[model samples]
Target: MTAAAPRPLPEWTASAVSPLDAKLGLELLEVSPERAVGRAPVAGNTQPFGLWHGGASCVLAESLGSLAAHAHALTLDLVAVGVDLNATHHRSAREGWVTGTATALRLGRTLASYEVVLTGDDGQRLCTARLTCSLVPPRR
Candidate 1:
């Protein structure tokens, strides 16, 4: 049998998919599980006040969990869409790019849920997020 073709992920789904990381100045990285092994830097995603913005943390969390959901759906050729998302900031990163990792709590046929935790360079908690996505039939 021939090898299966590599699947296509959304621009938001792939690693380093940004067309202008330099312009955005984000050294984005993606990792799975929340055990602290999977954390990506935020680079320039900080507020002018010198602390990590809530939106920035949200993006990082969403990116990771969505990736997991999509990858999970790929097994069945399903398309995943984020239906609901939530985040709780436990602390702040005053300097340096923060890293956030996601852990999957549920991966079902119709929905997948993941939890993301962000930490500062000093290894302090910055934020925590939860994302839920719906897996639907893929378009032909």
Candidate 2:
């Protein structure tokens, strides 16, 4: 049998808020089960050295990955909670926005994983990250 096409993500307003995301000035461009895209401005997210903070990159990566995983879980009548996240900083972003794209690596009944790549405006990789989430029944 042919593999089934992936289901389209449900309609969701782009108003999901996280205090850390807001503090870092992250803007969500798209959110879906297949992928999640967002950008964080460097102005407010920089470290004392004037470079983008590695922690900020991790926050962006986790935000995208978790959002995508959660979206995927919704299709199965489940909820997702991030169980693990990690990031390796490849380079520093001194100016402009850093864009993050989270692509699903695996989507299953009880688990989901995504790889998130953060890049500078010039399209150079700044960080690589992975996030795994546990899918579970929604709490009553």
Q: Choose the strongest candidate by lDDT.
A: 2
**Candidate 2, 1-37: lDDT as tens digits:** 9977644434563556588888989888778888998
Cα distance off (Å), candidate 2, residue 48: 0.9
Q: Which stretches of candidate 2 lie over 4 Å from their true place?
A: 1-15
Question: Which pairs of residues collide in candidate 2?
Answer: none
lDDT of each: 0.68, 0.89
Q: Write the per-residue lDDT of candidate 1 for residues 19-106, one digit (tens) a residue.
A: 4333334443433322112344454666778667788777767766776777778776897788988999998876666777778898
Indicate which candidate wins on TM-score: 2
Shift of residue 122 alpha carbon in model 1, Å: 1.5
